[model samples]
Target: MYERTARESMCKFCKYVIKIYGNQYLRKPNLNDIQQLYEVHESKHGFPEMLGSLYCMHWEWFNCPTAWRGQYLRGDHRHPTVALEVVASQDLWIWHVYFGVACSNNNLNVLEQSPLFNDIESGVAPDYSFEIDGVKYKYGYYLVDGIYH
Candidate 1:
């Protein structure tokens, strides 16, 4: 578990998403950082792109400077900011997400409370397929991780 102070510092990541992705975002848990977060979920976090190739791409996008740089030092636009990404695939369906935030359990909590995982609980599984327009559409976290349906 994260200390009160540590969790507070990590909250910047959550706030950034709330400001950008609105109040709707999934929360997982506070993670060490983008790198560590990827290590934890890459196994179950599928990839329609390829094996390790797409996973690498997902990591790159997650820590991409262009996509995520506003959460550092009072949202300063001059310094280098890191990006973050998450990807998952199921059967013939795949999901991809690129955003800025620490991938910690605590951070996930914040995300869980956001609009992303508003209706999901901690133990529920994500849904990978859904019907749309008389056809089945693959669905999952596009830019955030949470219950997939």
Candidate 2:
């Protein structure tokens, strides 16, 4: 009974937080935001039009339901988990976030499901052009590790 009550309280708190700060905290960066991010990242990382660093994190679900354990299990971990892919700048401002993916999936799989490139696909992305070593390049890019292709 205590566990049930705690779970309900947690759910209510989560919903309230989302309702109050969801738009500001949990949204993709717009054109102006992207431009600013590119400038900051480029000045610091020596990469023109660079947005931010991309990474994925796995969070263990200690209270995972028994029926869904197999689907969320990653391998040999003996626990169910969920993944969160994020693109965050040096200042810790999150530009992109994709969560709730099963741990069994890899970064590429999660990326495929993410809306990271949705603006590009919809032709609403801002124009990003910069000169590097006398070579003019267009389009901003994120600094992802070898895991992402």
Candidate 3:
């Protein structure tokens, strides 16, 4: 939860920058607080719950393998050493996080036919939407490794 909370703060800070600067830095506030905002916004200016989920779910995060290694490795310094993007419901919990690597590296060919995919469901079938700040967001994640898209 600590990681999530810190991420929420960073996202919120980014969002604030975007609103005030008009995307000057291509900034976007993190939706970590989207749930809280969703609730408040709905009360003040209502929007459909489903829509809320969709909006909240449209976020991406970098899934770095180096970070997972528990040892700092100086990467190219200009690019993400390893990254992946995840899209799914919140907590949308990954049954096998390792599968993330296979997917991102395009190595799923060997893994997909395994029991991994069967055990790990993808997409929004289970629907794990949550409220942050007054907006409802669907939970999804993807790997991003660099500053430039």
- Locate the minimum summed-lDDT window of 10 residues in model 2: 140-149
For model 3, the superposed segments whose C-alpha errors exceed 4 Å read 23-63, 66-149
Residues 13-113 of candidate 3 have per-residue lDDT tens digits of 98888789654433222344345544655665664332132211111234546554332122323323333333232333222222223222333443444
lDDT of 1 by residue, 35-59 (tens): 3434544556732212222232112
Score each candidate by Cα lDDT: 0.40, 0.76, 0.39
- How are the candidates ranked when ordered by TM-score, highest leading? 2, 1, 3
TM-score of each: 0.22, 0.70, 0.20
Higher-TM-score candidate of 2 and 3: 2
Instruction: Give a tens-digit lDDT track for model 2, residues 1-149.
Output: 69999999999999999999988986768878887887887788877677788898887898999998889998857678888888888899877777857788887787767777566556676665555665555544432342211
Off by over 4 Å in 1: 1-70, 73-79, 90-93, 101-110, 113-116, 119-149
Maximum-lDDT candidate? 2
Question: If the candidates were sorted by their lDDT against the true structure, best first, what order would they fall in?
Answer: 2, 1, 3
